[model samples]
Target: MKYPSTSTRSAIAALLCCTSLVPGQTAAQDAVQLPDIILDSGAVADDQTIVAEAISAGGKLTGDILDIPASVSVVTSAEIERRNAKDIEEVLNYTAGVVTNSYGADDRFDYFSIRGFNAYTYRDGLTLGENFGGIREEPFAFERVEVFKGANSAVFGVSDPGGSVNYVTKTPRGARFGSAYGTIGSFDTKEVGLDFGDVLNADGSLSYRFTGLVRDGEREYPFSRNDEVFVMGGLSWQPTERTELTFVLDHLDRDDVPGSGGFPIGYDFDRSDTFFGEPDFNFRGTERTTATLIGRHDFGNGLSFGGTARFSDGNDDFGYAYVSGQTATDANRSFFASDSAEKVAIADVHLAYDPQFGSFASSTLLGFEASRSESSNKRYFGPAPSVSIDDPVYTGAPSSVPLFADGETEVSGRAVYLQETLDWNDRVIASFGVRQDWIDITERDLLAGSSATNDISATTGRFGLTYKATTDLSLFASYAQSVVPAGTGVEPENGEQFEIGAKWRPLGGGTLLSAAAYDLSKTNITRTNPVTNLPEPIGEIRVRGIDLEAKAELGAFDLTASYSYIDPEITENGTAGNEGNQPARVPNHIGSIWANYTLEGDGARGDMTFGLGARYSGSYFFDDANVAGESDSYVAIDAAYTYALSDNTELAINATNLFDEKHVAFGGFYADFYSPGREVQATIRRSW
Candidate 1:
C-alpha cells in the first residue's frame, strides 16, 4: 500500500486547518494589491462581472473596457440569460462590427464574421482546435463572451487581423448558489438544466460547482433532430488566502444531430420547413471531453504569476447528403459519410510586475505559450441519389458504400511575448507589446501515401496610446500587426491595422458611447486547409470601416444600440474573376437597437419586465466572383417578457424573428440558405 508523503500530508493538513472562508465561499480572501489595469485574478469579486464592464481578451489581461485601446464588445451573462440564446452565434447577433448565423438555421456549427473576416473562437483563453465536425458547445455553460477587434497577434500569437472571441466560462464561485430550469420552445424543443455550487470542506479552502443539461430538439428542416447531454464540474482550492488553483472538466455527448440542408439558387424561402434528405440515412453524432486548470500566485511582492492549461479530445461521425447538382425540378444528392477525431493541448504562463513611482506607474508582463493539435478524418461516398426538388420523395437508405482513405494533420506551435503599459499621472497611458512565434505542421495524405512538413516563424507587435481628455471622455489610437501560416511552401499571410477611437460617458455613470474608424489590409489572403484545418494564404484583401455603439442603464430602463459601415475590396487574386470585387457575404451596413424596462412593485415578488429589439443586415454578394448576383437585405425583430412569480422563482417567454419573415440569410457553397422564420420559447426557473 502507498500513501501520501509526509510533506504532502502536512501541507494538506495545514490547508485544511488554515484561516479561511468555507468551501465555495467567496469571502475573507486577501486580494492581490495590483492596479485594476493588471487585473490580478484574485481581485475578481464574485458576481462583479454580470454586466461585464471588464474584459480579458483585448490584452490577455483583465481590465476596464474603457482602458483597453482597441474596439471591444462584451456580452454578459445577464444579457445571455435575458435573451435565452439558442446558440453561440445568436448570442452575438446584435453586436456591432460582426455578423452571426451567416448560414441561417444551420444547426451543425456556429458561423460568424468579425470585421469582415472569420475570427478565432476561444474558451478561457485557449482554442478548441480546428473542428473535426462532431463537437457542439452549449451556450448555457458560459459566463460571458468578449469580442476583441483588430490584429492582436502580438498578444495571442496567431490569428486573423479581424479580431477574436473569448468565452469566459462559469466556474466555482466563492458563495453558495443553485438554480434549475425547464424549457419548452418552437421546433419541438424540450430541455432541462441545473447549476449548483458549494464549499467542499470545513475550511473555505475548497469549493466546487456542477452544471448539467439535457435537451431534445428539432431543426428548421422537418425530420432533422438535435439531441444532447452536457455535464461540467469545477473545483477551486485556495490553500492560502493570497494563492489559488482551479480545475474544470467539461463533457458533451450528442446522440443525434440535425442534418444540413442545401437547395438551389432562387429557391422558395417558404419551404424552409421541408426536409430533402432520407431520414434514416442522414445521421450525425459527436462525443467530446475537455479539462482545464488555472492557477495564480501573488508573491506578496510586486510580482505575480498566472498560468492556464487545457486539453480536449473528441470523436464525430456523420452520415448525410446534400444537393450536389440540380436542374429545374430534378436534384442530384451527393451522399457522404465520414468519421473524424480531434485532440488538442494548449498552455499559457505569464509573470507580471507592477511598480508605482510618484506620478508615473508601470505594469509589465512577460509570457510564454505553446500548443499541439491533431486531427484525422476518413470519408466514404455512395451512389448518388435523385429526388424531385419541387416535391421530394422519401426513400430508404442504400446499402454498403466503398470507403476511401482520407488525410491527417498534426500542428505544434510555441511563442514568447512581452508587454508594458505606462500610466502617466492617470492622464496619458501608453501600451506596447511584441511576440515571436514558431510553428510546425505535418500533413499526411493516406491515399497518396505522402506526407509534408512545414516550418514557419513570424514576429508581430502592437503599440497604442490613450489620453483622458476629461473624467468622462477618453481618446485612443493604435497600430497592430498579425500573421497566419498556411500550406507547405506558401509564405504565411500577414496583415496590419491602424485605428482611432473615442469613448465617452456624457450622462455620467452607467452610460457609455463609443466610436472607432480603422483601415485594415492583409497580403496573402488565406483559406481553410483540408488536412490541417488552418488558414492558408491565397490572395490579398483590404477593408476600411467605422463602428458606433451606445449603451445605457438608467433607473428602470436599459438600452443598447450599434451601427457599422464597411467597404471591402479584393485587391489581388488569381484570374478567378474575383479581383477588385467586394468579398462575399461582407455586408456594407449593419445596425441594431434593443431596450428593456422593468416595472417594480412594493415587494420583489411582483416585478415585471418587457424587452424588444430589431436588427438589419444589408445586401451583399453570395460569392467572391462578381458574377453571382447580390442578395436582398433583411430586418429581424425579437422580444421577451418576464414575470417574477416569487423571490426565488420566475416565468419567462422569448421570441426571435417575431414576424416570421422568410428571407435569405446568405448564399454560397453552390447552394442558397434561408433564415428561420420565427421561434418562441418559455421557461420556468427556480433559484435559492
Candidate 2:
C-alpha cells in the first residue's frame, strides 16, 4: 500500500515537539507543556483528583486552574496506577470530549478523537504518535497524561484544532521512591516493571531515576500476539539554587501482530473463532532511541530563561494481510509490507518576566522554537493466498511482494511567539498572545526520481478574559486559532474556535468542576470525492460541543467524571450529497465515569479498594454520504479490586469489557473496526 501523501507535514510537527523537552522535563503542568515558559516552582498536584494544579497546555503556566480560560485535563501517576491503563488511549478514558479505541483491538498505534477530530500524541510536549515512523509507546514509561482541548496556536504554533494529548516522561526528582511489580492475566500474558529514584547528593543538588518494563501477551484475535520491552533513565543537576539542568534517555523494542477488524461481511462469524488472515505471516517490529536535555536559569527580580532540546532515531518493519474479496466462507487475501526510518531534532528557548505590581501583577513571555525531521519509507503490496472463515487452510504464504512506493520526506518549522497575562486584584485576568510560524517541506519520490518543495507561513493568536466572581467560581471566554500545513501544493488547513466556560471549586481547591462550550471549524480540509474518486481541497467542516468535567476527593473517595456532546457537520464537501451530513465515525454523545473507594482495614487484606467505571458512545454515521446507516452504540464496563498484602506489597485485579460486549467502532473500514473483547489481569507490586 502507498503512503498517504498529505501525511508528510507530520514530520515537521513531530520534529518540533522533540525540541520542546525543556518545557516537558520541567513541565509542571497537568500534562501538556509549553516551550520557553518553564517555571521553577511547579509540580504535579499531590491531591487524589489526579488533576495537575498547574497546566501550561491550558494556555499559561500557573498553579491555579481557574487562572486560565481554557479546558485542560490531567491524569497523574497516582491515577495511572489505579487505572493500570495498557496504552495511551486508556489513560484518557475518563477525560471529557475525547473518544478512544475507535478501531477496536489495534495495537500498532494509539488512535483517538477529541471533540470530533483526531488528536496528535506527544511525550514531554513532543510529538510521538503523529511521527512518520508510526511510533508506539508503553504507558509504563510516563508519569502522567494531559489533554488540551481546542486550538491555541498562540500557545503551540502547529497543532490540531480539536485538541492535544501529552505524556510526561518519568524524570529525576529530589524525592526517594522505589517500586517493582509483576503481572499475569488473560490470554497467557506476563509482565514485569521496576521504578526507582532519589536524591544522589547532599543538599539535594543532584538526583537520578530509572524506569523499565517488559511485557508478553496475546491479542484478542486468534493466533495473534503483542509484546514489548522498554527502558528509560534520567539525571538532574542543580548546580546553583536558581539554576538547573537535566538529561534523559530512553529505548524501546517491540514485535507484535497488528490487529484487524474483519471485513464488513456482517458479524455472523465469531471473531475469536474465525481466522480472517494469515496470522503466521503477520508482524510488526520497531526499535527506537531518544535523548533530551533541559535547563533553566532564574534571575532574581522576576526574570527567568529556559531551554530544551531533543533528538530521536527510529526504524520499523511491518507485514500484514487483508481480505480483498470473499465468497460465503472463502476469501481472497492481499499482502502489504513496509520498512521505514526516521530522524527528528528540535530545540526551544524562552524568557519570562513576572513582575509583581503589588495588587496588579503581570506575567509576560517571549520565545523561539524550531524543529526538523526526515523520513525514508518503502512500501510493498501484492497478492496472498486464500482463506476460509470456518476451517481455514494456511497453505500459501506471500513472502514476496512487489514494491509499490519508495520515497523520502523532509520537514522543518520555526516560530516566534509572545504572550502577556495581566492580573487585576487577583480577581480578573486578561491574556493576549500571538505567534508567527514558517514551515518548509520537501518530498522526493525515489522510485520515480522526482522531488518537490513547498513552504507556508501563517500568524495565529488567542485573546481571553477571566472573571473571578468569588474565591470558588470563575467565568471565562476565549478565542483561539491553529494552522496545519498540508502536503504538496495544498494550502494549509486553518482551525478557528470560540469558547466560553465556567470553573467552580465548591469543595475547596482540591475539588474542581468545569464546563465549556465551543464552536470549532476547519477550512481547507483535503478530501476525496466518493463518486469521482478525486481529491478536493476546498472542503470545510465544523464541530460544536460542550464538555463537563469533575475531579475531587470526598473523604476517602477520589473520583473523576465527564460528559461530552458534539455536533459535527460537513458544511462543504467534495463528495456529492455529503453537505450537511454528519462526519463519519464521530459520535455525537460521549460520556464516561470512573471512581474507586478505599475501605478501611479489612479482615485479612490490609487495605482494600474497589473501582468501577462505565463508558458510553452515542450512535454515529458510518460513511461520509450518510447512506450506510449508523453503527451500534456500545457501553463498556470496567472493574478493579486491590488488596494491600502489607505496607510494601499489594495485589490487584483489573478487568475491562467486563461483560465481553462486542460492537463495531468504525463501520466498513479495513482497519480494526470492532471493539476489543474482554480482558482481565492480576498484578502484585512492591513499593516503598
Candidate 3:
C-alpha cells in the first residue's frame, strides 16, 4: 500500500534549505528535539520516543519521563517472558484497570474490560471484532503491548477513555539465528517452541524469521484439555537506505475438550463449585483455525504506510446436557447443541507530517480504515414431550424432537479520521481530531425465514491541552466523544469523557509519579426487548475515577506500583431509579505492585534475577440491578527466578497465584468463572 502525497514534506525540506541564510550556522546547532511530530513507518526520529516504540522495544515508558497528556502503560517483553504469559489475558492481568472473563471451557471466547469500558483486542491498530467464534491472538508473535488509558478519540477517532490496547508485532531484523525453549507446568502441561531467523545476503537486503510452537495441557476442571500449535514467518527487503518493505504470514490451530461451564459463585463464595443445572453434562470439544498476512513500507521521508489482511475459520460442536427436576427429565439430558463460524477482513492507511512555522511546531495525521465481518450460529435441541413432572418417560426419548432454527449474523464497519497536534516552546501542546464511521448489521433465522438489518452513521471529536507547570511537573486536560452501535434491536449510544491530571517527577528521571481524575458519561443508550420490540429508556451512566502510578529504579532494584478508584453510577434509567447505582462489574478499588532485583556474577554461571509481584481488586456488582454482588477482593502473588546455566543456555522457574486466592475474577447471571489458581512452570532455553 502507498500513502497519498501532501505538501508538509516539501515544505519542511524548503525550510531546511532556507536555513543556510543564517551565517555561521551548522546543521547540528539548528537541530532541536522536534515537537508535535509524526513520522512515517521507519522515519521516527532518534530523539523522539513514543510509548508505542517503547513497548515494541521491550523498554519502560515511565509516566514522569514522557509528555503525553494521557495515562499510558507498557507491558514489556521481558515481563511477559518472566511470567510465562501464554495469552493476552495472562499478560494483561498484571496491568492496572483491566479485567477479563472467559465462558465455558474455551479461552478463545474471552471478554475484556478496561477502566470500566469494553476494550476488545486489536492487531496493528485495528479492532478484530470477529472473535465470537474463533478469532483470537497468539502472544508469542507480539513484541509488546501498550495500553492508553482515558479518552483516545483524538488518535483513534472512536474509543472510550476507559482505555485502548495495541499489540505490536515482532519483525525481522536481518540477522541469522535460532532459539528454542521447553516448559512443563501444572495440570500436566507441556510446551515447546522454536524461533529461527536468517539473512539471505551480507548487504542487509533480505531476511526472514520462522517461528513455531506446540502445547498440550489439561485444566483444573474435569474432561478439559488444551492443545494448540502456532506457526509464523516473515520476509523483509531493504533495497535502499531510504526504502524498506516487509511481508508477514501467520497461522494458528487449536483444539480443546470442553469442561463444564466456568466455576460459579456459590452461596458462600466457593471457587470450586459449578452452579449450572447439572454436573455430569457433556460439552464435547471444539476446533479453531486462523491465518493472517501483513505488509509494511517505509520511505525515508517523514511518511510511511502499512496494511494487514486476516481470515479465521472455526468449528465448535458442544452439547449442554442438563437435568431438570421440575420437568422430571432423565438424569442425562442435553439442553443445547450448537456449532458456529466467522470471517473477517480489515485495511488501514496512515500518514504523518512534522513541520515548523517560525516558533510554532505542529504534527498532522490522517487515516482511513474499512472492515467486514460475518458470523453464523446454528443450534439443535432434543425433543421431549414431557411438559410436566408426571411425564418422565417422554423426556427420556432423546431423538423424538425436531430441529431448531439456525441463527446467523453479519456486521461491517468503515471509518476515516484526521488529527493534528500543535506545540509551543516545549511547554504547551494542543491536539484536535475528528472521525466519521458507517456500520451495518444483519441477522437471519433459517427455520423461521426471519431477518433483520440495521445501519448506523456517526461522527466523533477530541480536544486536549497540556501545560508544563515547572521543570518537574505538568498539567493536562482533555475531552473526547465516542459511539458504540448496538446489535439487534438496540440503538447506538454516545460516550463523552473529561480528564484533568498532573504528572510529577521529583527526582528528575529516576522516579516518576502521576495522578488523574476523570469523568465519563454516556447518552442515548438503548434498552429494547427482543421479544416485544418495545423501546425503553436505557438511561445514562457516569464514571468518576482517579488513577495513581509510580515507577522507580534504584541501584539494581526496579519497583512499580499503581492504584485506581472508580465510582460508576447509572444516572438515569427506566427500570431503575437514578439513585447512583454502580455500574455492573466495575470495581471500586484496584491496585498492583511489582519489584525485581538482579544479581550479576563474573563466573561462567552468569547472572541471576528474582522478581515478585501482586495485584488486588475490590468488590463489584455482578448484576445490573445490584441486588446480588461479588466481593472479588483478593491478592495474587507471583514469583520468578532465572539463572544462566551457560553462555548460551538459561533456566527459569515461575509460580503464579502463590496464595491460591479462590476469589472470583469475573461473573454474570449467564456465566461465571474463577481465575486460574496456583500454577507453576519451569523452562529451559538455548540460543545461538
Local accuracy of candidate 1 as per-residue lDDT tens digits, 172-222 = 875566666778888787777777777778887999987777776766676
lDDT of 2 by residue, 1-688 (tens): 1121232224323323432332222332422311221234443343234655666432234347787888878887778888888877788788899888776676677777888877766666555545223576677887667788898667766777888777777778665666667888887777777776778778898998878776667777777766767778899999898998889999887877776626435645566666677766788889899998888899989999887778999999888777666667777678888999999998778898999987999899888888999999999998887776566687645658999899999999898889899999979999989989998999998998988887989899988899999978889999999887777677888998999999998844567899999999999898655666444586788999999999887776878899999999999875466899998778899899988898969566599989999999888887888876667788999999999887667899999889998877655533225788898999998665
lDDT comparing candidate 1 with the true structure = 0.77
List residue ranges in candidate 3 displaced over 4 A.
1-65, 101-108, 130-134, 157-161, 257-259, 262-334, 380-405, 469-474, 488-490, 504-512, 530-537, 576-579, 664-672
User: Which of the two, 2 or 3, has more lDDT?
Assistant: 2
Which residue segments of model 1 deviate by more than 4 Å?
1-50, 129-135, 256-260, 401-405, 506-508, 527-538, 603-605
TM-score of each: 0.90, 0.91, 0.81
After superposition, candidate 2 runs with Cα above 4 Å error: 1-49, 57-62, 129-133, 261-264, 528-535, 602-605, 669-672
| Deviation from native of the Cα of residue 428 in model 1, angstroms | 0.7
Model 2 lDDT, residue 300, Cα = 85
By lDDT: ranked, best first: 2, 1, 3
lDDT of 3 by residue, 543-591 (tens): 8888887766677776778888888888888755645777777888888
Query: Judged by TM-score, which candidate is best?
Result: 2
Write down the lDDT of every candidate, Cα atoms only.
Answer: 0.77, 0.77, 0.63
